[model samples]
Target: MNVTVKYFASLREKLNLSEEQLTLPQGVNQGDQLKAFLCLRGPQWQKVFQETGPLQIAINQERASWQDIFSDNDEIALFPPVTGG
Candidate 1:
């Protein structure tokens, strides 16, 4: 299935990308599974996705959890935790 992945805030800078379309492999249907797939890209990705603290995820603009499943054409947004003074 095809999904659109978005990066925001520091994650955008770290990944050097704002968004991209992904063709997910079979059995990779959940948020956590997607993360694991990206981390396999290399150390840079692993650092931002694996070593970093909790990230916020949204599926189709609604808040989503690691267990959330994905569907074709879904939009997944990943961002760092928000903080306010």
Candidate 2:
């Protein structure tokens, strides 16, 4: 299935893209699972998303937890915690 991923702030620099269209395998349905899969890409992905920096996810503009299920064409946005002004 195809999904749209959006990255913000440091995450965009880490992956080197603001957004991307991903074609995922069947078992890659959950947000956490998807993160794990991305980490498998290499050091950049692993370090940027795996060990450090808490990344927030929004599924179709709604806040989503790691266990949230993703569907085809879903828009997933990733951003770090926001700070108050």
Candidate 3:
């Protein structure tokens, strides 16, 4: 399936990227699976994704979790946790 992926805040800084258009291979249908697919890009990608604890996700602009499933033409946003005092 094809989808758009976005990175925000520190994740963008670390990855030096803001957005990507991807046509995923078969069997990648969930948030966690998508993340694992991205992590395969390289060590920097792995570090930015795997080392970050429970990064936030949004599916088509609505908040979602790693377990959430997504589909073609979907917009997936990933970001570090937000903390406000």
Q: Is candidate 1 or candidate 2 better by lDDT?
A: 1
- What are the lDDT figures for the candidates, one per model? 0.92, 0.88, 0.91
Between candidates 1 and 3, which one is better according to lDDT? 1
Predicted candidate 3 versus true structure: per-residue lDDT over 1-85, tens digit per residue: 9999999998888888899999999999899999889989889888887667678999999999889899999999999888999
Write down the lDDT that model 3 would get: 0.91
Clashing pairs in model 3?
none
Which lDDT tens digits does candidate 1 get at residues 2-85?
Answer: 999999998998889999999999999999999999998999999988656899899999998989998999999999888899
Model 2: lDDT equals 0.88
Q: Candidate 1 deviates by what RMSD? A: 1.0
Q: Residue 14 in candidate 2 has what lDDT?
A: 69
After best superposition, candidate 2 residue 68: deviation in angstroms? Answer: 0.9
User: Compared with the true structure, what per-residue lDDT tens digits does model 2 show for residues 1-85?
Assistant: 8999999888897678999999998899888888888888888788888654788889999998989998999999988887899
Poorest 10 consecutive residues of model 3 by lDDT? 45-54
| C-alpha TM-score for every candidate | 0.94, 0.91, 0.93
Candidate 2, position 53, lDDT? 73
Q: How many backbone overlaps does candidate 3 show?
A: 0
Highest lDDT, which number? 1
